[model samples]
Target: MSLVSALAIYFIIWWMVLFAILPIGVVTQEEAGEVTPGTESSAPGRPQLLKKALLTTLVAGVLFAGIYWLRVHSGLTLDDLPFKPPSAR
Candidate 1:
């Protein structure tokens, strides 16, 4: 892949991994028994966003590496998928 394409793929993968990781290890104010008067109980008591972000970056990097290998070394392409319509094939 070109530099732009590689960067774009990595960016997409990073965002996806971030979303997937966001709900993990969550602690709501209600769950922690520390719901403040003004805030909703459903709000997170300690989001630990920095840690999740770091983890997301690591996971996304590994996933992107696998995808890059499939695209480059394995010569896998969109047309090779089995679900394509007969006309397209």
Candidate 2:
């Protein structure tokens, strides 16, 4: 893949991993018993976004490395899939 394609794939994977990690270890204001006035009790008390972002980057990097290896070194392609297009059949 070209540099632009690699970067784009990494960006998409990073966002997906970030969303998947976002809800982990969440602590709502209601659960912590410190709901601020006029704020929703369901709001996260300590989002720890920086930590999650770092973790997401690490996970995404590992996953992207695997994908890159498969694409560049595994010698596999869409044609290797077991299923075939109806038209092709």
- List where candidate 1 sits over 4 angstroms from the true fold: 84-89
Clashes of 2: 0
Which pairs in model 2 have colliding backbones? none
lDDT of 2 at 59: 100
Clashing pairs in 1: none
lDDT of 2 by residue, 3-86 (tens): 999999999999999999999999999999999999999999999999999999999999999999998999889888798557
Q: What is the C-alpha RMSD of each candidate to the true structure, in Å?
A: 2.5, 2.0
Error of 1 at 51 (Å): 0.7
Error of 2 at 21 (Å): 0.3
Residue 5 error, candidate 1, Å: 0.7
RMSD of 2: 2.0
